[model samples]
Target: MTVNNIAATFLLGGIALSTQAQADFLRDGKATLGLKNFYFNNDSREGAAKPSKTEEWAQGFMLDYKSGYTDGVFGFGVDALGLLGVTLDGGKGRSVGSTMIPVGSDDRPVSQWGRLGLTGKVKVSRTELRYGTLLPRLPVLVANDGRLLPQTFEGGQVVSRELANVTFNGGRIEHATGRGSTDRTGLAAVGGQRESNQFNFAGADWRVSRDLLAQYYYGHLEDYYSQQFFGLVHTLEFSNDQSLKTDLRYFRTESSGKNSSGAAGYRISGYTKEGDGEIDNRTWSAAFIYSIGSHGVTAGYQSVSDGSNFTQLNQGGLEGKGAGGASLYLYTDRLTQSFTRAGERTAFGQYAYDFTALGVPGLKASMMYLRGDNIKTVSGDRLKEWERDFSLDYVVQSGALKGVGLGWRNGKSHSQAARNQDQNRVFLSYSIALF
Candidate 1:
């Protein structure tokens, strides 16, 4: 049967079971509706290639429902998500790229589009098994939510927390729905067209001490690559309400199966080893943050090996395949560019302030700057780049619209090897709960 048919069957079956089960199944249920109005604009600076500008505006609706488990040793539950997007103002020339909305045959944004996702779950003690649509937040993969809607994966996952101070996660994903598309596509790397049906991952998070945490994860994409990740996080607190946080991450990736020999149409884009277009790379980063009351400062450094660009689940190369934008699990993944080129080194710093310290609650601002250099290119040219970003956010502190939020973000980047660009975004959002 088709995926849609399977999803419908799961939805109908869940409803039937919930209706006949104990009252706890429905009594403990919860639902929420979220509304968002978004505006996005990007301008390519002078001397840049491609279109000079792209602009779009849209409204989004998200309905989420989660049901509690039934009364039994092995409990059952269900979750449903409904997403809708409407174009407020956008045309063919302004919506050429699938930034916030998908483009149609006429190269214009569709009037409106939506999708429904459902998952059936079973719980036993502290362990849960879930099947169907999933939005996973793991070190190996992160669901993209930078647009009107969040990306989702199709498959099954198991999460267990039976051990104290430890959590385990494992899953198999077969398909993905882009944040801006209504259709689902098979899993593939950024520049690869051969789809892989088996993307398997397993990971565990361990809390070694009160202020220290460690993580390890392994991922394998059939005929593509295999990857391993290690992470460490620690925080130091002082009596004067001051704290220091440290984060370290590393990844080791190598090609597998068809990609190892550059056969079966499995080829990677960009720079790689001279022999074949195979994947082999190491990337790592370290970040430190200092916080005192409402004021915060951060500094970070990252490096990429000389073998190839950092690899992740990017579908930008799969045009007309229902996938568009993607995100990487790195601190250098920014608004204008990702500093993951081969042999690149990046240094970044940021400062943030919360207005509550100045008697203005629910207001905050932050600014960041990043500089990268020593980038390795196919022609052995050393490239350099930099970006600066600023953001402001405010929320209604009281009255009828107490929870309403407004945000603005602006970024500019200049590079010797990439495009120079400026981007801005504005968002208004609110959420209501129904129990």
Candidate 2:
């Protein structure tokens, strides 16, 4: 159904339900107001166009309301999200590449912008159907939330848990509103200019045991590409607060329709087999994490096939600047770069510590590094790159400021395929319950 139809369903359901049902819906409903103050700065060290730096500060507000399903064999409910962003600083030159703020006609940052979203939902037995605004976190499509506001999609999704040890998910996504945008746009690949209004996906997760899970998913973007994903995760517990976790992921992707025919607007960008711009790639990664006490160490290796760069849904090449942010379900999707170039091989490691054992119950810190080499270049050369990232976060555990969170992140990247840059972000956030 269309967005309008979904909205109408919410309205009509509210009015048509019996008084007892309405009472149940409202009784179990909840609302929250979230606040975030963010500051971002990115300095291009080399190999970038003019306006070598992007700096901005902003305040964000989000209101979330969720209603419980009515009391009946078939239940109905609704959810609403309200997002607002106000620029505290930065304009024109300094805001060039800041994706958290919107730009205006004169190439300046907009003072403020806001949007509202609604979702209609229905439930029966152990299955649920939701339509309208969505934030999907599946293997093929991950809604971006790296900025002040999160990316949202216009679509319909169904999740079922009728099976004892398995869960099923499927969806059809038609459009997206970027994390920094107030308008919705069609979906496309990272460098694709043409819009593909239909994206179909289905997936299933099976819990094999108490500590092991298996997943399989398929996604198809009309006229663009199709992909299949397989994943496995397991955790092993040891003595003395020690544990080991293993995660394995694999993806196979290939061109379809226009993309397969090498059409201009539908073809992907970046290195491809014979420079044909076709989508053909196999990517995989495996990570192992060992935790002891309050410390965790992780190591992983990833590989991208030589035929083409890994592909997923991205709207960066679309018309709006805010349309550029996207998130990938890869360990390599870091703060500054995604090691996804064709023929790339990357090794990454991370060290994280929680301060709870050290008397600071709300503090945590992490450091990560990734090095990628053997990146295929169109000129038949191999390129290499590396990145280092650091993060520190704290949340108040008690008192008046309980649940208030503060965070700082820093990343430096040196790359042969793109610009070298240093980036920093600081944010403070809190959420208030509302009846």
Candidate 3:
């Protein structure tokens, strides 16, 4: 059945049956649409000639509908999401890279594009089953939300919260769509394009204590990649006026499906065996942040051991896989020019302060820096790059724009192998809950 048909049927079933009994079975279901008047621009220090800069403005819309479940031992419900993008200004010289919207077969950008996704949900107590469109964020597999739009998946999922402090989730994703697309395609890891669909994953997160937690995740992409992760987070109090926080993360990845060289061409670059073959990637990182009132400081280090580059779906900077939106720990997934990959080592530090300590209610500022060395490059010397990020955020405490939020981002990236990059982004966002 079509996506619209399935979603419409579920919506009707819930409403029609409730109406027959004169009961408000679906009392709180409503449709919501949003518009983000977004402006984005990126420039590389290399100058003209080469494609170093991109700029655009567009209105992104997301129409979502959620329904109340039927009352019973087994409850049933459905949800639908409609995404659309309209270009306010974009053409040959004006259009940037793959930021706002994807280019079309015509060679230039399309006036607009959209997609429709529907999901059927079944619930039994705290355990829920969802089939159809999926958005996953487990360690091994994370959906991309880095563009004016978000990338999604097509699959089945089972999420259970049987334990009060523990959440268990597992799923199989067969297809994926880029943040800028509606059409679903087979699954593939970052920089992996051998056409291996089935992606299997399972994970559990335990809230060990009020301020401490642990997580374990495992994932496999048919013939492309296999990954596992372990993570820990904790916050410790030292005194009435001081505290220390730690966030530790680690991952081990190997070759799977087609990339195993069972049939497909020599697995894409650097993914072979540990040093001479394909697939042997392991990475770990730790970050510590200490906050005392409005003044906070943080430091982190990350290392990767693999011939091939580490990969993950990033929703910032770059719109593709393995990109980081904002990160100082080296693994930051900014999709900008390219995902940071290959022989790599990184160290970073950040500091943030709350204006409330300074007597200002809704003002905050932070700055961070990350430096990476020994990055793998096909050319000669290992690649080297670093970035510095500064952010200022403000919110109106009272009045019409009370909950409105404004954010600013400025960054610069320099690479020893490629051109330098500079970027600036300003975002204005607000949300209203209509009951």
Report the C-alpha lDDT of model 3 over 226-309, residue by residue, as the tens digit.
Answer: 888899999999887688999999888777656666444325454333343356677888899998988899998888774567
TM-score of each: 0.96, 0.98, 0.87
Look at candidate 2 and tell me the lDDT of residue 86: 93
> If the candidates were sorted by their lDDT against the true structure, best first, what order would they fall in?
2, 1, 3
What digit string (tens of lDDT, one per residue) describes model 2 on residues 74-169? 888999999999999987888853378888878798999888888998899999999988999999999999988889999999999999999999
Candidate with the greatest lDDT versus the true structure: 2
Report the Cα lDDT for residue 112, model 1: 88
Q: Tens-digit lDDT track for model 1 on 1-435?
A: 654566566546546664546476688889999999999898987764556788889999999999877777877777889999999987878875458888888888988878898887888999999888899888888888887888888888999999999999998988888888887888877687788888899999999999999999999988889999999999999847799999999999888898888884577777785646788899999999999999899999999997878887766666585577778888888889899988899999999999998999999999999999988776665899999999999999999999999999999999886779899999999999987
Whichever of 1 and 2 has more lDDT, that candidate is 2
Whichever of 1 and 3 has more TM-score, that candidate is 1
lDDT, residue 222, model 3: 72
Q: How far is candidate 2 from the true structure (C-alpha RMSD, Å)?
A: 1.2
The lowest-lDDT stretch of 10 consecutive residues in candidate 3 is: 321-330
